[model samples]
Target: MQITPVTPDLAAKSLPVIADAFANAAHSDGHEADLVTALRHSSDYRPEYDAVAVNDEEAVLGHAMLSKAAVVADDGQRWPVYVLAPVAVTPAEQKKGLGTALVMYLETMAYGDGIRALSVLGDPAYYGRFGFVPARPFGITAPYEVADENFMVRELQEGGLTGVHGVLHYDPAFGLTPQA
Candidate 1:
């Protein structure tokens, strides 16, 4: 399978398949639709931030997204970062390392583009293979309640998350309503 940046037309065409994969993967999770919607609207949803793995026949087998993220600095500046979310592989494609290939490709692309850090709420067991670890080590916290082990970050640059702290602010597309 080849991992490639998703073109606009291909992205649109693959939405239904990606959504179905996400829903099935996230079964019983209250945020599947919200997550899908957020992914569609996020600034990072561009062709550059999204990718798909296609088979020799060019059929999309997996999808991944990396979006804008921020870490608050001691002086109150928001240090730019990236958030990886809702990575999905077709059920039939699971356990074949397609997800790993997709993520590794995206992470390398992100680093080449100057993205220093990446955060995700995902299984550490899977992501740890890619150097992701609990974000708390770098003083990072999720905007919503999440299992500490599930909220993880990886620094692409040396000491990328060093001394970084505060709540991670995702792009507004995450569907979090502000208090009145």
Candidate 2:
């Protein structure tokens, strides 16, 4: 399987697959696909961080993305960052590591882009495998009240989070509100 950026053609074919995958997810709120769509149109969306997993035939197997976000300190300070949202793998392709591959590819891109750290709100066990840890310990917190385990962050660079502590604010697309 090859992981590649979500080009227009790939996105046209992959969105439905991504929607179905999340629709069937055990923890989905039935709106993850919508979130991806909204993020795609977001000004903060970085196409380079959006990706798809495809087979030898270029059939879409999975989809994932990182979006612009920030860590805001109480003193009115903000540290820009990225947040990994809605990593989806078709149910039929689940357990074959397509999701992991998608995530790894995104992370590799983020690191290359010089991103200091990134956060994700998801299954701790699954994300932990990628070296994610509770954000609280790093002085980072989610804008919403999520479980300590579900809201996690990973430092991509050495001492990336050092002295960078604040509430994580995701792009408005993540809020799931209709864009004005």
Candidate 3:
């Protein structure tokens, strides 16, 4: 399968695939597809940060989006971050390495573009394979209450998070309210 950025045509075909991908996941909220659609239209959406894996017949097999996020320091500083959410692969394609390829591709794109860091709320075992480590140890907090181990972050380059620290917030489309 070939991984490519999501185009209008590819997007139209991938929505259902995305929903199907998460259908059986115990962690699914049943709105991942909607979340993706909302994210695509949100200000956080970046063409370079999203991609689709397609087959030889040009059918979309999986999808992922690395969209904009921020870490708000107590000093009122906002540091840029990218959040990897709702990575989806058709049930049939799961465990075939398509997800890994899509993630690596997006990471490569981010690193090439000089992004400093990225975050994701996922299983440690799954994301750790890509070098993700718990963010709490690094002073990064999620906007809402999530288990510390569930929210992870990774530096794209050496010293990427050197001076960055605080609460990481997702785009409004994620439907999460910051802790008051």
Which prediction has the highest lDDT against the true structure? 3
lDDT, candidate 3, residue 69? 86
lDDT of 3 by residue, 59-166 (tens): 999999987888989898888889998899999879989999999999999999999898999999999999999999889998877899999999998999987888
| Structural similarity to truth (TM-score) of each candidate | 0.87, 0.94, 0.96
Q: Deviation in angstroms for 9 in model 3?
A: 1.0
Candidate number with greatest TM-score: 3
Per-model CA lDDT versus the true structure = 0.77, 0.86, 0.89
In model 1, what lDDT does residue 105 have? 88
- In candidate 2, stretches whose alpha carbon ends up further than 4 angstroms from where it belongs are 176-180
lDDT of 3: 0.89
Off by over 4 Å in 1: 26-40, 43-45, 73-75, 177-180
RMSD of 2: 2.2
lDDT of 2 by residue, 1-180 (tens): 788888898987778887889876778889887888889999987788889988889899899999988888889788888989888888888898888888899999999988999899999999999999999988888767688999999999999999999888778888822211
